[model samples]
Target: MKYSYEFYRDHLEMLRIKLPGEIELFADFIEDISIEQKADEYITKVENVLNGLYQDFEIQLNATSVLIKKDMTVLEHFYTYEEPYENEMETEEFKELMLIWKSKIPERFKKKEN
Candidate 1:
């Protein structure tokens, strides 16, 4: 697989506070809908969903840390965010804000319980 399950799981864990109680169901939703059997495809779908959250809600996600640049292979894009911070987000406070924003998922956006 291009990406291991741990990679995807780690990102999910980082976003755990944002996710609702229906996390297992959400996982199933992403995995079952993936076109590829590999776990990477499911991860891609989950990333897209998270990106959608960022865009739709103007959520301040540190997408540079979690996003996979389309058309680039995993190896090519893996460490791009590991570079020294020098832009608008260079401060530790900004990084902390990103984490807070990541966890600030709107309640309505979470998976609804039946």
Candidate 2:
């Protein structure tokens, strides 16, 4: 399940960091579940922006991938992503949100349109 651009923006806000360019529009690949297979193609383009802002950011990750079952059960699959630090990241609100997001995994993040 892909999030709306606003959702992405909300998360990006928590990073308190600037990206040099536009992220690929969510509309561009909203239907591309197969994107997981070709994610390597986007690494360099995305990494160029992220790496400049964050040393621990996982540019190699296509962290958007989700596993959805017939029962509507969902699981987020991510790797090598760094946890946001309270001191270095955003506010207490952001930290609380992140912790909730991590604890709940796909449950907390399941797209409303799903």
Candidate 3:
């Protein structure tokens, strides 16, 4: 998929406009929705949800780094970024944050819980 830096910037903008708890709600929606065997509005909503997760990561990375352009498929941004500095605290904190964004999968799509 093609991910643009501007798209990521927009996603982060939504996070700043929203409270953190509401941000988590969006994250939960992404984690809960399945891409397989779905169509129409649900797929669109889930894709939007993933876009939000990508935006959160961009915001966190940009907050700590110069945000120079770099190439990485796993990221989104307005500019490419090199990896930011890391200490245990930051790593642990990022992991915690990502848990809300990326920490769910099922045995299969059919097993998805409501």
Candidate that scores best on TM-score: 2
- Higher-lDDT candidate among 2 and 3? 2
In order of appearance, the predictions have TM-scores of: 0.19, 0.20, 0.20
Q: Mark the regions of model 1 whose C-alpha exceeds 4 Å error after superposition.
A: 1-87, 106-114
- Candidate 2 residue 83 Cα shift, in angstroms, is 36
Clashing pairs in 2: none
lDDT per residue for candidate 3 within 1-114, as digits (tens), equals 111111111222222112142122223223333333332333333334345532322222322321111221121222325332221122222233333323222232233233
lDDT of 2: 0.28
lDDT of each: 0.28, 0.28, 0.27
Model 1 scores worst on lDDT over the 10 consecutive residues at 56-65
Report the C-alpha lDDT of model 2 over 1-114, residue by residue, as the tens digit: 121122342342221212212222221222232333244433332343334442322212244432212222122334324432111112222223223333333332344442
Which ranges in model 3 have alpha carbons more than 4 Å from their true place? Answer: 1-22, 25-94, 100-103, 112-114
- The residue pairs that clash in candidate 3, if any, are 5-77, 5-78, 68-80, 69-80, 70-80
